[model samples]
Target: MAFGIMMLFVAILCAIAVIREVKERNFLAVGFAGISFLVFGWFSVMTIFVSGAPEM
Candidate 1:
């Protein structure tokens, strides 16, 4: 869960990076950021789903 949350944060940052790279017309950086976003996002989401959310 902790790992998932950390990855989720990283994924968000990568998403922001992707947008910045696109705006700057840096396709190479965009590709790398986009890939990291996808991989981290998928891993985080799956991890959360598999572990289940905490109850309030």
Candidate 2:
């Protein structure tokens, strides 16, 4: 659940960054947005695959 929240936060931040980049006409912001999305995806996948409890 924490990871999910983190992903949401990153997504919101990315959206804000993209909007700012569009207004400022900066291409580097787009790169940062891309990296943020990749990190979000990675965290989501890890959260799904990694369980807190071990299965016997």
lDDT of all predictions: 0.96, 0.73
Q: Native-vs-model 2 lDDT?
A: 0.73
Ten-residue segment with the worst summed lDDT in candidate 2? 45-54
Residue 32, model 2: lDDT of: 84
Badly placed stretches (over 4 Å) of model 1 are 53-56
Tens digits of per-residue lDDT for model 2, 1-56 = 67766776777787788778878888898788867867786776577566433667
Per-residue lDDT of candidate 1, residues 1-56 (tens digit)? 89999999999999999999999999999999999999999999999988886766
Tell me the deviation in Å of residue 24 in model 2.
0.1
Residue 5, model 2, lDDT? 64
Q: How much does candidate 1 score in TM-score?
A: 0.91
* lDDT at residue 15 of model 1 (Cα atoms): 100
Lowest lDDT sum, 10 consecutive residues, model 1, at 47-56
